[model samples]
Target: MKRYTLSSLITRLASFEEALAQKMDAKGYVEAAERARRYASEIREIRDFIIVEMTLEPIETLDPMEFLDDAANPEEVDNLRRRVYTKIAEDVEPVSGELADLLRRLSS
Candidate 1:
Protein backbone atom coordinates (compact mmCIF):
# COMPACT_ATOMS: atom_id res chain seq x y z
CA MET A 1 0.00 0.00 0.00
CA LYS A 2 1.16 3.53 -0.66
CA ARG A 3 1.69 6.00 2.15
CA TYR A 4 0.42 9.57 2.07
CA THR A 5 1.57 12.49 4.13
CA LEU A 6 -0.56 15.35 5.41
CA SER A 7 1.12 17.80 3.04
CA SER A 8 0.32 15.53 0.11
CA LEU A 9 -3.29 15.37 1.16
CA ILE A 10 -3.48 19.16 1.38
CA THR A 11 -1.97 19.47 -2.08
CA ARG A 12 -4.43 16.97 -3.50
CA LEU A 13 -7.30 18.82 -1.86
CA ALA A 14 -6.19 22.07 -3.54
CA SER A 15 -6.26 20.32 -6.90
CA PHE A 16 -9.76 19.08 -6.16
CA GLU A 17 -10.83 22.60 -5.26
CA GLU A 18 -9.51 23.92 -8.56
CA ALA A 19 -11.24 21.16 -10.52
CA LEU A 20 -14.50 21.89 -8.71
CA ALA A 21 -14.27 25.58 -9.61
CA GLN A 22 -13.72 24.78 -13.27
CA LYS A 23 -16.60 22.32 -13.28
CA MET A 24 -18.89 24.83 -11.66
CA ASP A 25 -18.10 27.35 -14.38
CA ALA A 26 -18.59 25.00 -17.33
CA LYS A 27 -21.90 25.35 -19.15
CA GLY A 28 -24.17 22.28 -19.39
CA TYR A 29 -21.79 20.07 -17.44
CA VAL A 30 -24.01 18.29 -14.98
CA GLU A 31 -21.87 15.15 -14.78
CA ALA A 32 -18.73 17.13 -14.21
CA ALA A 33 -20.42 19.08 -11.44
CA GLU A 34 -21.51 15.87 -9.75
CA ARG A 35 -18.00 14.46 -9.94
CA ALA A 36 -16.61 17.69 -8.52
CA ARG A 37 -19.12 17.55 -5.69
CA ARG A 38 -17.97 14.05 -4.84
CA TYR A 39 -14.37 15.19 -4.83
CA ALA A 40 -15.28 18.13 -2.59
CA SER A 41 -17.03 15.87 -0.11
CA GLU A 42 -14.10 13.48 -0.01
CA ILE A 43 -11.72 16.34 0.60
CA ARG A 44 -13.90 17.69 3.39
CA GLU A 45 -14.19 14.29 5.06
CA ILE A 46 -10.45 13.76 4.95
CA ARG A 47 -9.81 17.23 6.37
CA ASP A 48 -12.33 16.78 9.19
CA PHE A 49 -10.95 13.36 10.07
CA ILE A 50 -7.42 14.68 10.22
CA ILE A 51 -8.43 17.66 12.35
CA VAL A 52 -10.13 15.37 14.84
CA GLU A 53 -7.26 12.94 14.93
CA MET A 54 -4.77 15.70 15.47
CA THR A 55 -6.93 17.51 18.05
CA LEU A 56 -6.89 20.67 16.01
CA GLU A 57 -9.57 23.31 16.12
CA PRO A 58 -11.82 23.52 13.09
CA ILE A 59 -11.42 26.64 11.01
CA GLU A 60 -14.28 28.94 11.90
CA THR A 61 -13.75 31.74 9.44
CA LEU A 62 -12.83 31.38 5.81
CA ASP A 63 -11.99 34.61 4.01
CA PRO A 64 -12.83 34.22 0.37
CA MET A 65 -10.64 37.19 -0.41
CA GLU A 66 -7.59 35.18 0.56
CA PHE A 67 -8.11 33.01 -2.47
CA LEU A 68 -10.04 35.33 -4.69
CA ASP A 69 -8.03 38.51 -4.48
CA ASP A 70 -7.62 38.63 -8.25
CA ALA A 71 -11.11 37.38 -9.08
CA ALA A 72 -13.03 39.80 -11.27
CA ASN A 73 -16.31 39.26 -9.49
CA PRO A 74 -17.05 38.99 -5.77
CA GLU A 75 -20.18 36.91 -6.40
CA GLU A 76 -18.07 34.16 -7.84
CA VAL A 77 -16.27 33.77 -4.53
CA ASP A 78 -19.56 33.53 -2.69
CA ASN A 79 -20.86 30.95 -5.14
CA LEU A 80 -17.76 28.84 -4.76
CA ARG A 81 -17.99 28.94 -0.99
CA ARG A 82 -21.65 27.99 -1.06
CA ARG A 83 -21.01 25.05 -3.35
CA VAL A 84 -18.18 23.80 -1.16
CA TYR A 85 -20.22 24.10 2.02
CA THR A 86 -23.18 22.37 0.40
CA LYS A 87 -21.01 19.48 -0.69
CA ILE A 88 -19.56 19.20 2.79
CA ALA A 89 -23.05 18.91 4.24
CA GLU A 90 -24.15 16.23 1.80
CA ASP A 91 -23.83 12.54 2.77
CA VAL A 92 -20.89 10.71 1.32
CA GLU A 93 -19.77 7.10 1.18
CA PRO A 94 -17.09 5.87 3.52
CA VAL A 95 -13.54 6.71 2.63
CA SER A 96 -11.92 4.69 -0.13
CA GLY A 97 -9.51 1.83 0.52
CA GLU A 98 -6.46 3.93 -0.17
CA LEU A 99 -7.51 6.67 2.24
CA ALA A 100 -8.58 4.09 4.81
CA ASP A 101 -5.19 2.45 4.65
CA LEU A 102 -3.47 5.77 4.99
CA LEU A 103 -5.54 6.63 8.04
CA ARG A 104 -4.76 3.26 9.60
CA ARG A 105 -1.06 3.85 9.13
CA LEU A 106 -1.32 7.34 10.57
CA SER A 107 -3.14 6.11 13.65
CA SER A 108 -0.65 3.29 14.22
Candidate 2:
Protein backbone atom coordinates (compact mmCIF):
# COMPACT_ATOMS: atom_id res chain seq x y z
CA MET A 1 0.00 0.00 0.00
CA LYS A 2 1.12 3.55 -0.72
CA ARG A 3 1.51 6.03 2.12
CA TYR A 4 0.36 9.62 2.16
CA THR A 5 3.11 12.16 2.33
CA LEU A 6 3.03 14.73 5.12
CA SER A 7 3.77 17.50 2.64
CA SER A 8 0.78 16.56 0.51
CA LEU A 9 -1.53 16.55 3.51
CA ILE A 10 -0.26 19.98 4.57
CA THR A 11 -0.52 21.51 1.08
CA ARG A 12 -4.07 20.25 0.63
CA LEU A 13 -5.12 21.57 4.03
CA ALA A 14 -3.54 24.97 3.39
CA SER A 15 -5.18 25.27 -0.01
CA PHE A 16 -8.54 24.43 1.47
CA GLU A 17 -8.10 27.01 4.23
CA GLU A 18 -7.06 29.71 1.78
CA ALA A 19 -10.11 29.05 -0.32
CA LEU A 20 -12.41 29.12 2.71
CA ALA A 21 -10.88 32.36 4.01
CA GLN A 22 -12.15 34.25 0.97
CA LYS A 23 -15.71 34.24 2.30
CA MET A 24 -16.74 37.22 4.49
CA ASP A 25 -18.99 36.58 7.51
CA ALA A 26 -19.13 35.05 10.94
CA LYS A 27 -19.28 31.69 9.24
CA GLY A 28 -16.12 32.45 7.31
CA TYR A 29 -14.35 33.52 10.47
CA VAL A 30 -15.47 30.32 12.13
CA GLU A 31 -14.29 28.28 9.17
CA ALA A 32 -10.97 30.10 9.09
CA ALA A 33 -10.50 29.48 12.78
CA GLU A 34 -11.29 25.82 12.35
CA ARG A 35 -8.79 25.57 9.52
CA ALA A 36 -6.17 27.41 11.58
CA ARG A 37 -6.71 24.99 14.42
CA ARG A 38 -6.18 22.10 12.02
CA TYR A 39 -3.02 23.76 10.70
CA ALA A 40 -1.69 24.18 14.22
CA SER A 41 -2.27 20.50 14.87
CA GLU A 42 -0.34 19.62 11.72
CA ILE A 43 2.44 21.94 12.90
CA ARG A 44 2.72 20.06 16.18
CA GLU A 45 3.10 16.82 14.26
CA ILE A 46 5.94 18.40 12.28
CA ARG A 47 7.41 19.59 15.56
CA ASP A 48 7.38 16.03 16.80
CA PHE A 49 9.34 14.96 13.75
CA ILE A 50 11.98 17.63 14.35
CA ILE A 51 12.24 16.57 17.96
CA VAL A 52 12.50 12.90 17.12
CA GLU A 53 14.77 13.13 14.10
CA MET A 54 16.91 16.20 14.81
CA THR A 55 16.77 16.21 18.60
CA LEU A 56 15.72 19.85 18.76
CA GLU A 57 13.04 21.99 20.32
CA PRO A 58 11.04 23.48 17.44
CA ILE A 59 9.89 26.66 19.15
CA GLU A 60 12.50 28.87 20.70
CA THR A 61 10.13 30.76 23.00
CA LEU A 62 6.54 31.76 23.56
CA ASP A 63 5.53 35.29 22.58
CA PRO A 64 4.94 37.28 25.79
CA MET A 65 1.99 39.03 24.13
CA GLU A 66 0.14 35.76 24.00
CA PHE A 67 0.18 35.38 27.77
CA LEU A 68 -2.02 36.90 30.48
CA ASP A 69 0.86 38.76 32.08
CA ASP A 70 1.28 40.84 28.95
CA ALA A 71 -2.35 41.25 27.91
CA ALA A 72 -4.53 44.17 29.03
CA ASN A 73 -7.26 41.81 30.28
CA PRO A 74 -5.58 38.85 31.81
CA GLU A 75 -8.61 36.63 32.30
CA GLU A 76 -10.08 37.20 28.86
CA VAL A 77 -6.79 36.75 27.13
CA ASP A 78 -6.05 33.62 29.09
CA ASN A 79 -9.44 32.19 28.27
CA LEU A 80 -8.93 32.87 24.59
CA ARG A 81 -5.54 31.25 24.73
CA ARG A 82 -7.01 28.21 26.41
CA ARG A 83 -9.73 27.96 23.77
CA VAL A 84 -7.30 28.20 20.87
CA TYR A 85 -4.91 25.69 22.39
CA THR A 86 -7.74 23.35 23.18
CA LYS A 87 -9.07 23.52 19.65
CA ILE A 88 -5.65 22.93 18.19
CA ALA A 89 -5.06 20.04 20.55
CA GLU A 90 -8.35 18.49 19.51
CA ASP A 91 -7.22 18.53 15.89
CA VAL A 92 -3.71 17.29 16.67
CA GLU A 93 -4.43 13.77 17.86
CA PRO A 94 -5.19 12.02 14.59
CA VAL A 95 -2.31 13.62 12.73
CA SER A 96 0.10 12.82 15.52
CA GLY A 97 -1.15 9.28 15.68
CA GLU A 98 -0.45 8.89 11.99
CA LEU A 99 3.03 10.30 12.46
CA ALA A 100 3.68 7.94 15.34
CA ASP A 101 2.63 5.01 13.22
CA LEU A 102 4.92 6.16 10.42
CA LEU A 103 7.80 6.45 12.84
CA ARG A 104 7.17 2.99 14.24
CA ARG A 105 7.13 1.54 10.77
CA LEU A 106 10.41 3.24 9.90
CA SER A 107 12.07 1.83 12.99
CA SER A 108 10.73 -1.69 12.63
Candidate 2 lDDT over 13-50, as tens digits, reads 34433333333123445544554455435544554453
Show where candidate 1 strays beyond 4 Å. Answer: 1-8, 14-21, 24-27, 51-108
lDDT of 1 at 95: 24
Candidate 2 Cα lDDT to native: 0.37
TM-score of each: 0.32, 0.28
Q: Write one digit per residue (lDDT tens) for candidate 1, span 9-96.
A: 4444456555545645564455545655555565556655543344322222223224443323324434554543333222111323
Q: Show where candidate 2 strays beyond 4 Å.
A: 1-3, 25-108
For all predictions, the C-alpha RMSD in Å is 13.0, 14.2
lDDT of all predictions, in order shown?
0.42, 0.37
lDDT of 2 at 86: 46
TM-score, prediction 1: 0.32
